[model samples]
Target: MNAENPQSPPVASVPLYQLKAEFFKTLGHPVRIRVLELLSTRDHAVAEMLPEVGVEPANLSQQLAVLRRAKLVHARREGSTVVYTLASAEVADLLRVARSIIGSLITDQAGLLADLRAADRG
Candidate 1:
């Protein structure tokens, strides 16, 4: 926005990579990741998630707020309970892709370990 022009459209101050880095940083927490993974399966109420997430109520609420700010999840009121769901199906896909990548890496590591064991035996 120009100082002289009061009605000018907003310009992006942050670079794309910086924005992406911030987004990944939002996912950097273990509790946040667990909450996202749970939301990936289905919409969960705060009460329901309390047990599953294995965190104190205040901690879970804080984690949920971080996810909400990141726009990775949506929250709605169902009576007195707050229900949360993934903001996009792509989030679940991202989780699945991450699992596949980690699985492959672990498989490769296991193969290397087996080879080492065989060499040691010989």
Candidate 2:
């Protein structure tokens, strides 16, 4: 683990948690999340996804580039249009799981708020 022995593989390789953190960081943008959600249903051209994502062409292009770099989506040229699709089905499943977990959190928070209100009324 020193500079001179840099080529040597450590007793343990890089931690999986660090890789997971990097993966989540790639998905940390609202625009990217929306783009992924749209692609989850079906492939879409840049033109087709523009209005749905409600961003300027420049912004959309930027987000697409990020997803492309992360290998989360694949882009192809169909005629003059640039179409994008999820790189794998697993991306869709991950989005779905995130939605489910967030939904549960929202429900739990609502219950907590209702309990607080009832206690205040007593």
Candidate 3:
């Protein structure tokens, strides 16, 4: 292998492990996930989002800040309010896939719990 081949792909200076860790860190919170889900549907004012997501204003604001910093959500000013939306339509697809996975996992867990309860009673 030639050391200076122009055709070679450039190596990433940041390690893949570090990048993965950061990605997971950004996604580890439930509130952030909900914010992503809401934005996936349409742009919404921060005040409007609070009631739908059932989170306190301070907490929702914090989660939105996290998503904004991660570049997952974009914001625009509308009069005195900030309207937030997904950075791309692809984000909505990502949220859909994530919800599917979570739904399957929850269903499986519920079945397992039922079996355990039956066994305990028997």
Candidate 4:
């Protein structure tokens, strides 16, 4: 243990649920979620993202700051352009899983509603 950073071990000792909750909290915003979804495909410049995301530059910048603090996106400077990309492939995997789960949920709800309607008519 380095005398300079004793807090590092405590961070590792924190419960997994707390870490997960904190991570989810970071993803609670729609803009942050959209930024992550776009970056999952490829690196994008701030200018390129603005139109696609349909947000003002200041709003997008706020979302990017949250993602950066969460360590979910990496930013690079190319001349005057600020390019953003996912920090890891796992973020993309998480997004894909979320889509699948929501899809399945909608399917289940439709099935339940159909059964209810059929029962009501019988």
Tens-place lDDT per residue, model 2, 1-122, is 64558887655567999989999999999999999999999999999899999999999999999999999999999998899999999999999999999999999999999999999999
List clashing residue pairs in candidate 4. none
User: Judged by lDDT against the true structure, how good is candidate 2?
Assistant: 0.95
Question: Candidate 1 residues 1-108, lDDT tens each?
Answer: 666686896765899899989988999999998998998889999999999989999999999999998899999998898999999999999989999999999999
TM-score-best of 2 and 4: 4
- Can you write out model 4's per-residue Cα lDDT over 1-122, one digit (the tens) per residue? 54669755533468989989999999998899999999989999999899989999999999999999889999999998899999999999999999999999999999999999999999
RMSD of 2: 4.3
As a whole number from 0 to 100, the lDDT of residue 92 in candidate 1 is 90
lDDT of 3 at 118: 100
Indicate whether candidate 1 or candidate 4 has the larger TM-score: 1
lDDT of 3 by residue, 1-122 (tens): 33588777776579889998997789889888878888877889999899888978999888888888988888999999999998889878977898899999999999999999999999
Q: Can you give the TM-score per candidate against the true fold?
A: 0.90, 0.88, 0.73, 0.90
**Which residue pairs collide, candidate 3?**
none
What are the root-mean-square deviations of the candidates from the true structure over C-alphas? 2.4, 4.3, 4.8, 2.5
Candidate 1 local Cα displacement, residue 5, angstroms: 9.9
Candidate 4 minimal-lDDT segment of 10 residues: 2-11
Displacement of residue 100 (Cα, Å) in model 4 is 0.4
How do all the candidates rank in terms of lDDT, highest first?
A: 2, 4, 1, 3
Q: Which model, 1 or 2, shows the larger TM-score?
A: 1
The model with the greater TM-score, 1 or 3, is 1
Query: Can you tell me which runs of candidate 4 are displaced by over 4 Å?
Result: 1-12
